[model samples]
Target chain A: MTMKIDCPFAAKILTVFIKEELAKFGFKKGVLGLSGGLDSTVCAFLAARALGPKNVLGLIMPYGTSFGEDVRDAIGAARLLKIRHKTIDVAPMVDAYFKKYPTENRVLRGNKIARERMSILYDFSGREKALILGTSNKTELLIGYGTIHGDLASAINPMGDLYKTQVRQMARYLEVPAKIQKKLPTAGLWTGQTDEGEIGMTYAELDEILFHLVDERESKEELLARGFPRAKIEKIMSKIKSSEFKRQLPPIAKISSRTIGHDFLYPYDWEK
Target chain B: MKIALAQISPHLGNIQRNFELHLQAIEKARREKAGLLVFPELSLTGYLLKDLVETAALDPDKSPMFKEFKALSRDISLVLGFVEEKSQEKGLFYNSAAFLDKGKVLHIHRKVFLPTSGMFDEGRFFAPGRNFRTFSTPHGKMGLLICRDFLHYAAGYLLFAGGSEIIIVASAAPGRGLAGKNGFATSRMWELMGEAISRFSSAFVIYCNRAGLEDGIVFAGGSFIFNPFGKRLVQAPYFKNDFLVQEVDPAEIRRARKNWPFKRDDKPEVILEALKRIVHDYED
Candidate 1:
């Protein structure tokens, strides 16, 4: 079952959220890592709409093994939105580090690239006096598909609650370039790496299962009865269980009566 | 009498700023020549305040703020929400709404139904109130219900039976779901309840909801006024602050009560006896 969202309504709420939340944090400008993927492109559109094109900046960071098409698309997305953008090749830093700590693992290389890109975005955020807008959708967040403290790091996320399929719908509504919207989602850590190829399932299938399991709170038995493969359901559940740490602040040992995350609970917007 | 609904965005845990905001709203309402101005739930302190509730709680009798509000009430009546500290019972707090009229604190209604399920933790913090009393005002007998209190049918029914002609609900309901055209699903839910209660009880229903984002939860600000016949008079837009004033004629209440007679035919004694037996049986 496709979960349909009212894109225009969602866009209105998200743009307002971006503008107001940023203003509350004493920020009128926003900076984001534009990967030319659906999620990042959608966020760029929202940021431009919220903070105005001049106030928004997109950083297109690429590694040596990154696809040329991906780089062009990122630049194209920024141009379409009429937001200021800069391209910084991160091959030297990532390659130099990997030379000393040599590894054939693709996941390790991808994690480093993700972290490197985020670091550049943060640096630009500080230099430009702007907040870093997040790009991770709910599907990647729940499945632990992205690197922690890497793509997951952001000041605020407008699209965090939206699923991947919903993000695609938003992309269409925002009139994001058809090339960027139709292209397979990739982190661009290396050539021929796609989110669906690595995850071994289409976003539609995963979103349906996740919508039922997470949003609807369907039990395993109920899922099986609804014609979902038991192995796939179990795999999704385990992924969610394992990725719980990425979604939360690191736990602190409770020594005092009032602990930060435990007894001493306060909203993040407190006193702001 | 003209009633003004002040849809405001309170700074979280910043009582001084929220106080200033309230003063501004009071000034605007007075300028608009409204007889009474109603604000959303916890207009003095923002919602989603987990640990700050204790810090924000104030004794209405001792606090100078209430004194100021009382002095301001000399010009126009006021109704607003705050975290009420029980002076006699230390460390206990109640999510309370106070009705100020003629330079005096007339009535205070602590929220009876503290929603503690599914993203809400009100029951964990606030002690549930035990009464649903109505107080007399210049317009008519009025009752105050917090956000969750209005959702309960019995709460509105009890107020209707207690001779209430106007039911004012101050709410901080977060926007949820996007299946509706006008506003969020949660917002639509409140409007339906407001319409139903106004029609059933033959009372004017005035709902004031807050605006702005607090910890990712956006308070839906579709504040509305419904006449005794359940016809919507005016509505503020969603997700934005607005000060809406609408003339509320008390004669509409008489006309509606005459047409429906829900109030005249209401049998509170039967309900009381049934509840007494049911509670005794359940406990036994």
Candidate 2:
């Protein structure tokens, strides 16, 4: 039983990881933005177990014209868990910005919504002094599907590594509402938008490709030979290569004698 | 309960070796029947790495090193440190601690206080955590404080307010004094910090510090356990890898708090006013 667990699926051990993490940081509760999608729902379930039902707060931030069922499913999951939850209608705030700047694209507006939701989550986190748990999955992180400084922000992330397929499995294990578990994955950025549709590839295929590419370190030609579409493999590889910057901190120039991103390589507790 | 202070000397960029050492410590802890086991700061990746962007990066979900640590969770309730790759966000590296039990990670605490002082540039490598709180576990209400975080009065006060019975300080304290000189200054500072912990929070404190050297900076491994009364219960060997075990009683915390009564008699507003003045002087 004293075997060493690999670090990648460390997020899978959420039951123990979240609790110990919270205790270590002195956090008794957690707040997260619930989008009624697989990622957020799984995060909510994990946070509830980590901090308890009373300690986990779910804030549903819905922009204008959200699918009604998605909101209901999110609320339903919270109710099922008996966790405290609230709804923050972001339609008015998002609409106001769009009205003022009519030329803004929906993508720009969606990014605003994401940032606004994060802002609210952080505000509540401050008031409650609760940690803001993140919900983005590994697939999103690898493919750069998340909005930078928006849905991508959190005090700590528990699901950064579970692929989209793995997230669905975790949702099932956590007994998430079927409505949420079965719903099409979407960022709710616009009407009739689905994650797969936008990405132009199914998660099963994406995960398979990514597993070969990242975990197996397969070459592009090998991935194509392994039944991955040439165009899709190229696209996913491009994302993984390009979004490496997004995965890291802002580059610090070697101005100081010991630069952080460069020379200074101590643990967060180095000064203790 | 026997508590094992697993003062592991981590490799700066070797996840596999560090994780193997962690597993070895857990086995030792179990054999000793220790109820809790603790590891040093960033035990997964060594401190003072040349490029954390490259050295400290870990995909806990996919990294083999993380998987090894997770499997080790079944036997002992272990605490260890590592770097976690955050989501695809700008500036999202995390200094993380994982709580492991029963073959799983019970919880994780990201480092909140990023040091930006001399020879330290954490603010540039990781995002600063904003929340200060406590966590509940089978062990009890516990608080996790990283290095430099215990120096912050607010973090300590918040831990007390959140009901932390035991405060664990996992650190890599820099050793002062020359190669041939005694580390008197570092030891004195650690003693002062222990006294502060006993006076301010009145909780049983366990400090686990890394031993050995990294990037020319020698870690003064002055790890120790402090009673609620500010008494040193056990002190590990300094400047070397060592482990010490001490039994902690919850009732002793109550006794110490009752004896001190600092928690009940303090004026928070007065303390805040003084702290604010130290940071900035505002005109009335």
Candidate 3:
């Protein structure tokens, strides 16, 4: 039940959305953390097409335990897109932070690594006068698979509405390298950390069911009647329901008659 | 029934320049051998006109540009959005759309809903219109809506009740909510509207939306056409100036209506009585 995404239409609007959104903030250039994954590669292609390769800056940050193949793929993506890119090793920073707060907690280490990469991307954003473009897809954002204030942090995100399956289609349409497109999806937070292994669901299955549940607004019984796995439907539905807060601006205390994020919620680009 | 949607980025307060753009688009559509061509709301005067609306109004009857449009319609029928200057009364205007063919205005629809809340200030710029009528065209019996009018269900219902075989909406919608790589959430919302009316009423639907940035607000320009079965026949590119030409079959409408006699079995008098009763009891 994989959805057939309209690739040409999606590509056109996304490229325009990226370029126009950037211009609204007076940014002619953009920055992104290229993980050599399908999502990042697709985003890099769109950004390059929108703002031209010279205006896009790709940062490839690999941890000490990251596979060398991932590094090669990231560099390959940058070269193919012909964007200004730099590879910065996050090993020293991740190691230094772990030394002070040593722990075997996988979640904490992953969070730290994500935040460190985010911090570096933001630094480059300021130095380069470029906005930070994001690579989080709809599935990851809906399920809270991304770390908050880490890789999820961005000035503007163009791919957030697309499902993982849709992302792959767009990547192939953008002509991303075969290595990046065929590679197993991973956050590279730790060695051998695959996204499907962590989420315990294939994107095609998740997207199909979610398309019905979210897009078609099908009820639980309706989904089960449609032949979706009961347990998988429950898992995906609960993840989306609980991660709602992450998709919104932080709640504000309503002491005044008008609150920035509440009563007086203005658009983010209102400043521009 | 070949229809063409010319999605152009109109310069604010420049009706002359926009008219020239329309001429170019009309020529392109003519070259494509299209039967009908449509443009977005205020395609002549760009959106967000607070102080410029007064100077932007064009008299559809007297304006020589409309004669040009009428002459062009001899080759290809045209639906265009412009600020219509109220002829009988000076200093009054309406956000209007004109249907032109064979050297005359076939119909003119002023926007019924003047959106005032949020970023829209149409109420401050022009007066709201009152009628929703369907008129004959070279292609089919067509109804016209200007932007916000299509957002209301009654607009479509009234047009359908008047025997509109096709509904054309000219919109100047700004893009918002970039939830994912899919572009504007605005697009999905509009698609839902177009799909429902096309299927339920067994009528063709043409939604022409503008593109490009307007004073920091980017117009999500995904102009598209849907057949009576709610199938998207053609789609224009979003966020850029573009056009699409597709041959529509009025027979699809006839087939859909014959299959589902919803239009045939409709009870318009009941709706009128209900609305009258509601209006009588309304306190607000």
On lDDT, the leading prediction is 1
User: Cα miss at A90, model 1 (Å)?
Assistant: 1.0
lDDT by residue for model 3 (B1-284), tens: 67899899887777777888998998899889998899999998887766677777889889888878888888777888998985886877899999988877899999999999877877877888999999988677889998889989899999899999899999999876544455676788888999998988889999999997655577988899989888888888767889888888888989999999989999999999999999999997
Instruction: Tell me the spans in candidate 2 whose CA falls farther than 4 Å from its real position.
Output: A1-12, A269-272, B1-284
On TM-score, the candidate that comes out on top is: 1
Count backbone clashes in candidate 1. 0
Per-residue alpha-carbon lDDT of model 1 for A69-123, expressed as tens digits? 7878989989888999998889999999999999999889989989998999889
Highest DockQ against the true fold, candidate? 1
How would the candidate models be sorted by TM-score, starting from the highest? Answer: 1, 3, 2
Q: Per-residue lDDT for B131-150 in model 1, tens only?
A: 99999988789999999999
lDDT of 3 by residue, A182-243 (tens): 88899888888899998898888888888888767789999999998899999998999898
Candidate 1 segments exceeding 4 Å error: none
Tell me model 1's lDDT, rounded to 2 decimals: 0.91
> What CAPRI class is candidate 2?
incorrect
Ranked by lDDT, the better of candidates 2 and 3 is 3
Question: To one decimal place, how large is model 3's interface RMSD in Å?
Answer: 8.5
Candidate 2 Cα lDDT to native: 0.75
The DockQ-derived docking category for candidate 1 is medium
